[model samples]
Target: MYGKAAICLTFVILFLVSCSIYIGTVDLRSYFFPLLQSPPVLRSLCATGRPLRVYMYDLPRKFHVGMLDRRSSEEAAPVTMENLPPWPSSSGIKRQHSVEYWLMASLLYDGQDEDEREAVRVSDPEKADAFFVPFFSSLSFNTHGHNMTDPETEIDRQLQVELLEFLQQSKDYQRSGGRDHVIPMTHPNAFRFLREQLNASILIVVDFGRYPKTMSSLRKDVVAPYVHVVDSFTDDDPLDPYESRATLLFFRGNTVRKDEGKIRVKLAKILAGSDDVHYEKSVATPKNIKMSTEGMRSSKFCLHPAGDTPSSCRLFDAIVSHCVPVIVSDKIELPYEDEIDYTEFSIFFSMKEALEPGYLVNHLRQFPKSRWVQMWKLLKNISRHYEFQYPPKKEDAVNMLWRQIKHKLPGVQLAVHRSRRLKVPDWWRRKR
Candidate 1:
């Protein structure tokens, strides 16, 4: 009996220790959240405390990056370091891996109504084995309250209204294995980006919850085995996908537009100017398809600047390409801040700083290689481990919805253990 008691005590201690450890425990809550979800942001935690653990559902590391005219790999070119960033420095883990069992399912939201991304990833046109529900696109800029006269904002708001209405109109979800899966989006916060990703994962998604009168037209009325009730995501967080390569895009012209051509030109300049940087670029797509694992292996930062966007795909490409992004957008509304290591994980040059080319160049030139390297490694580890706290990308907003449902209809309890008091009474004989 004494031996058994000792063993149980040891086990209890181990359990408690594990519970207190947040390092590797994947927080499913963050997976669906982007940085903007909560206010009075989680900035200092990443810098001061035990790091925030995350399940990074990042893309495979070898997707070749090239100019738009020569965009995406062609499957024919010889992959070389000239085309890719430096390999992630040697913690010795391969970046190309799929955390198969832990993932509930992957979903993509283009926010442009462009199904091409989906079309490229999946094969079947009609039927499906594992399929993703794509949100057609984001609202126009004017609609988002950016500027009253901004037509784009107006369009953005209209889409939000329409999407919200669809959610409210729904009473319940479609019949899957005979269950009432639908839940109410009934609140204003329901449509936030992170919430969107959750919504996509949930079974019953009220399509018109935002539109009070239009709540009658929930889309699940037509589509299913209706996704009304979904199993909550398991916190099957994967290890980090360490990245150590950098890609710099330097723009030389003031006439550069926000379009792909301009972006590519800037990218080429950065790549061309780069030697210790190790990369290559071009003005073409489809043909520029190249992936040199070596180049990605040796480098560490992607010098990002918008030829013309308040934000651009270059940032996404950084996360996707597995390169630490050096951002230049100040007004950028990055989705999730708390879960990421953006504390200089990404570098931001305010508009004034970037405009002064000589000063910017000199500052970077003056930056100690050791300091830059340390910053790069720190961010690389975070990106590899933490799912960037980004706003829900299209369907990701659907993800945010599941969170709401889980909140509204809280689930059953899991294993609950009472805390054991560790007594050290002065009157007692010293156990030690």
Candidate 2:
């Protein structure tokens, strides 16, 4: 009997030990598995939940809004939200290239209700993810030298020289070698005086038509939309849009252009004499802009051939008007392309296809009415992404541009870190 009891005790001890081991294994897994999974989740939360912190340099008014008002250079005080000048109402087509002004004004805006902003202006350089250089390059080009040969062109040149001097003296610029700095040069010739000096920085440009591959590429630069010259079409909902629109295609602008834009001249010839088409050679007077607005609103599709550049403000105007755009540029770069698909709302044609007589209009003529209506609906839905205004709205052009900048930050950070210890810059290029 004693021997039997001892065997039972030994079995009980073994069972308890096995139970303890199983419980310990369960506890360990419960403690460590979450620790392993938390990193990526935490990182995603930090990245998506937070706004991009930007440090804007305290530039004098002359560099930005001061150009709008012709403020004196001796006014040394930095532009503030209270002192910031409104964009001139009379600024016609120039307003299309005013990305620099809006970006600077966004940073200056101190409204308490701007909780949805994608970028928040920070005073500390160390906390900033990027730096903004708010020189009004486009305005300077428009104001000082519409005619390049004028003596006042020297004023634009001097502004660029002064801007370079100011940036060179900043330690933040030296730290990243201007790789992290943002400069807006939206005009084709905005910073022509010293563009080479800024080749390393993140350029805010409209297109790569004028720039060499080395100076600007999609890998580093952001292609911003030109603020549409025509106003947005607010009441576009109709019972029978396809039937109500009388015209098949509409194009009203300069006919003669250079490079790939030469297709415009060919198109003007091919599209001539079509009763359903309105092709006019016109300048952007107030009356012409109004007429163009009306034409786009009533048209089934708007023709967007290349202008001086591969992309033009007319394409954006078509988008905001809820008019389906028939794009003809082969080398155009679009804004927010990472998230927005152009094929959903616009039609594409190769230059050769567009230039061919009858082929261009015949296809558009046979395009299904149901499909055209679908594209028009899509255009109306996505048009908000292109609007740029003060007290910037969520996901509008200004905020959208900041988000694009955010997308580039990871690549910028990788480059900035790699440059710090590398003995020879661009060694990978040399190896290739």
Candidate 3:
């Protein structure tokens, strides 16, 4: 009896230490502890103040592996360091449309960094905080699904069907119902088939325009900035943006688009003949980008009206050029909102306000020289946060994305716990 009593006391002491450790960081006693019967059979905690462990799914060749082969053959050539935009000195080589590339690089290459050590890939799914489905969904869709009129010819649908089957069979996916899974859907048309089916999963999309509130929002999804294509202004370019910028407002892109994008056509008509605003239709070719770069650098405010989606790469380009972005989209979402405030750097105008004749330009002109200069300086400083670099940097787009995913852990934990008791419908229980 004395031996058993001593053992009980030891166990009590260890439990108290563990609870104290947990309380130091998060007061999860009222939040996560009560819901858990054991030490979370579904989620294995990271032992306090550690970067969350993420498991990258080893999918079949056709789904993600084959994508590298396909794009390497024809889509576009790899962007070398010579062509890369001016990034921070710490930044290494990076691709132009690098969302797919940087994600794969980070997952495959174990860099010499403490943060990278935190996100070590585990083969065991049971020990992971999140499951990363590294499907080059954007690359796959852009190659096979984009501009296809026939739904039957779409190859992404077949891949999605297979992916759904594979995920449903996994015990880990069954436990959380994909709430802990992270899938990149940066392209507007990515995951064309059964998007609603995978809505429970965390989607890394460029915007919420394609997804409804039931499946995606600021709550469950991440809004990633598009991979910028334009070259940035170097330190040798200009000392003063105001002195160098001759044009008041400049825009060069398609004028016609669906939904909120139609405002572009109206604004083009309104701003036409205004000497300060240079509005012209431009294509996304190599030569046109050179022309666009010149225009952006020479302009004070770069016009960023909505395209097919709520957000576009133009805003990022404007930032790299040290040009203040005059945004007109009301529903557009940006990345890293928790850390960086958009109002401090960029200007936002409602569709109603932008459509009004001369109101948009007049409002921009009303800002004093000091205010415009301050906003331009802020824009240049925040440009690094929007960039994706190889091996990942401290606060680059890749690191910020991981940080955002970390912020969702509490909410994901609650959802997983609630789901353990909540009865899901029969329709949501099917494998196919």
Candidate 4:
């Protein structure tokens, strides 16, 4: 019998195949900042003016087909997100190389094309500022039904060890001259590979911080620092603009897991009686909170009641999309609370105080779009700090790995995985 996780993964595959949830098509002219034809200009990147190249490598094995982000062919209009000035430097480096966002590359498990394999297996001893590894999965290596302690059978633990040790010991690996960084998802497997290839480099993890138990467990083994990008980062007083609508966006994970639908409905009634705060679309219950990141960004405000306690990504996504996060969960003990003011960045409604009839909406009505727009900019800047860098926000990842180049140890010898293997199998084998 498959465990709950395996069953869940199966469900995700089936549902995404059958149900098909999408944010909509992205046209290159608008969605992304740098136009494909032109080098995306960044005015505020480091003073060095070095273009950050992100190479996105493949998607997670389970959701590869359903994921729209991985389809490099899915074109979108140029994005205005990264406001940058065009460089006068030579066109070869500037125009030729696009940021190597890992999202663009095909997942190693997606296909067997030689080109794809080469792209996934590229050596980091040479060019490239960072090898992008978006969507980190540290605990995903549990495999089929077996766990860390389960009896081993057919597969070679060496492969597994390489991946896990890479994440653990290879915090100092560097590649591509002195400028580029070797980056991968925040998994024990990939991290191990990074360790084997690059050591002492910054190992960054970006994702929701809902899995406290799992995260707490992983933290003990952590060899590098990790950061998360929440869908919404709400403050104690989550205020909304007067003219803007008052509504919370949430894609369901499991409605049965909690009364998510009813919770949203109750909030809806409060906003409905008020002016201009009409709720649209029945409350959406997604199997994954990750799906709602973009949805929350599109909506005026996102509903963050914390699914079964203080588990919500609304706060991070809200700030990322320039939306407000209306948090209804009071059980959360957010990280870095002492450093950042939650009340200033996010709006919170205590579970006890939330359903007090019009209390939630009334507070939301107080926020104005103009004010939100300003707050949004502030949030975006703050988001950069929270945003889990594939290459890390600073130069530390590469620097961490770079320091190991002189190490006499075997871990950071800079031996790249040079063998050309099947693409889909590469991804699956790593996941296992």
* Candidate 1 local lDDT, 342-382, one digit each (tens): 64555677655655535445565556656665554454433
Angstrom error of the Cα, residue 104, model 2: value is 0.9
Q: Which runs in model 4 stand beyond 4 Å of their true positions?
A: 1-254, 258-300, 335-338, 368-374, 389-391, 395-432
Model 3, span 325-396: residue lDDT tens: 999988889876755667877899999999899899999888788998888777766677677766667557
Best by TM-score: 2
Model 1: worst 10 consecutive residues (lDDT sum): 93-102
Ranking by lDDT: 2, 3, 4, 1
| Every candidate's lDDT | 0.34, 0.86, 0.74, 0.38
TM-score of 1: 0.35
Instruction: List the candidates' TM-scores in order.
Output: 0.35, 0.86, 0.79, 0.38
Over 1-432, each residue of candidate 4 has an lDDT whose tens digit, in order, gives 569889999989977655543433433334353333121122121223223333433333222221223333324332222321122222221111111122233212233433212233333424433444432223223221134454531132443444444434433232222112333334323332224333333233222232234332222111222322334434322354323323433333333334332465555555564444434442334323345544554556656665433543434445565566677764555533323455656677787688797666666656666766665555655554344323232322222222221121122223222221223466687899
Runs of candidate 2 exceeding 4 Å displacement:
1-47, 71-73, 112-115, 423-432
Clashing pairs in 2: none
Which runs in model 1 stand beyond 4 Å of their true positions? 1-134, 138-168, 172-256, 259-298, 319-322, 385-432
Please rank every candidate by TM-score, starting with the best: 2, 3, 4, 1
